[model samples]
Target: MSDPHATSPEDVDLSRFDAIVDVRPQAQTRPHLPESTFTPLERLLEDPAASLPSTSARVLVVCDIGMRSAIAARELAELGYQSVTSLDGGIDAWRRHGLPLAGTDSLTPNELERFDRQIKIPDIGSTGQSKLRSASVTVIGAGGLGSPVISYLAGAGIGTLRIVDPDVVELSNLQRQPIYALSDLGRPKVAAAADSVAATTTQTATEIVQGSFDSSSAADLIEGSTVVVDATDSFQARYDLSDATRKAEVPLVTGAVYRWEGQITTLVPNGACYRCIFPSPPESAARLDCALVGAVGPVVGTIGTLQATEVIRISAGLAPAYAGRLLMYDGAVGTFSSVSVQARPDCVCQRP
Candidate 1:
């Protein structure tokens, strides 16, 4: 019942705690409790949906001298953690009580230990993780590009993922769409993708739209998204989603892959819209889908992964890579390149 943030060192007790979290910067924490875990304040702030112990568990947050730990505990309380507190004097107070110090590390004990590496990245840290937890992203398609995009986004803990695809999983899709299994062949792509995302992380809420994405349904499917990703193979769907997002002043991350080649770009409200680059749709005779063109698995993966990265970056308040540029990936030669894009004066996207 004691407030860890307010308890004095003389009255401190560790046995009452279910877990002790050290939130100090790793550099400043040379000696920490042997049993305590280290997760910096920024990391905790970034990961809005961190999978901590059960709400019933007693968690005591600690920092170098208690300032940040108190802040973190308050944040956890606001997030509805049932029992949370901060160490008053932090590690310094613990040492004063002659407690054994542990190494500098902070992560909850969970099966998803694989995320430790990325959680330590300065830019993404815990804060970025939290942002991903709060973000809602809608990916249009569950095919090759959608496969990687969905996998990465789901794995990264995107709070809500809306998958829209009218097609069903097919035998031919196994080569690149790793999110589906042989048994999923007859299932709708959105259903299969939802199952895949659920299996990846329970933190992400998967929304399925088992039909085509178009102007008619765009508002319902994508209007609330923090970012829209175009992974659909058809140009019509891409243009539809792009136009809808453009009108809503939302950002869209889109990519395309064809025969060992792929391209990625971000269409922001104020920047050049997708139509600015094309002016008009390609002729029916010239239009090509993967069915007619053929593409390698890695090509789609590369572009899809890039699209996912852009979504993550944008959600985390970081600069998007292809806002006014097109990133081209040549899988045959294993090279990546980019070209600047400008808003067409005559295009509707140029209007205020």
Candidate 2:
């Protein structure tokens, strides 16, 4: 006789169950059935009440090859789960039956584990994680602002990072640009940034563009990129990147720091561009370089971290936080403020 407590993949109708539970090991449980809850068999066996919903709910348990799920179903039934069933062949059979799975199939079991905590977020679940795994971001500079931006993005599992910089690491850069060490002094910033990203996560691929980001090179550097980050120190480079990304219809996250103050914003195609805010570069006397006036390391780090978050949000298909506004931070007072901004009618960004 066949087991009444088990159902085959052909008989499964996901809508009928209040909860579909995966009882496989955590590492093997990703890319599971859509909207399925993951409660490893070990955890479920130890405490069914804590691991799952009410026992009266219609539940379906699945595993790798069906054995564990079958055992779990029987145990749950004995524990007074009114309606529970196991997948007769588990995920293996579901796969054979050509059913849909959620995460990216390209991710290995190890990659799943490495990103387990991030993948657990409801908003950034396996689907969002997959998007991140396929995203490519082009960072315009590898200095203070780029340091935290690159580090955090790599940690967040961004698929590809293209770092562009024309300068070499100097002793003064070590204050805010943590991606390099003393030994790296005099080495190209792009190369050092690539090595830093590699150390953070092997899953991310790094492309080092050892050149400046200007109108001539901006198009090619940001081609095929999901987003472009403006971590440049000069207003000229920022304006160039903003125009390039706007023309290409790609999103751009731009940030700046001076002394203990910093600001960041995101610009999307057809929306407000950088010129909408500044209109033109500040006069040479007004423009302050960190090297000339000095900057607080944490101030740049703070702005860079926020810029990275914006990049991740855009890459994962979420709304940009600072799309048409500027977020400013005052490290001296430990306060943050935001100002609304709009597209300039007379600026090139508004031209057809």
- Model 2, position 227, has a per-residue lDDT of 93
Cand. 1 TM to true fold: 0.70
Kindly report the root-mean-square deviation of model 2 from the true structure over all alpha carbons.
Answer: 7.5
**Number of the top candidate by lDDT?**
2
Query: What's the TM-score of every candidate structure?
Result: 0.70, 0.76
Per-residue error for 180 in candidate 2, Å, reads 0.7
Model 2: CA > 4 A from native: 1-31, 34-82, 85-106, 284-288
lDDT by residue (tens digit), candidate 2, 200-226: 788899999898888998889999999
Q: Specify the poorest-scoring 10-residue window by lDDT in model 1.
A: 103-112
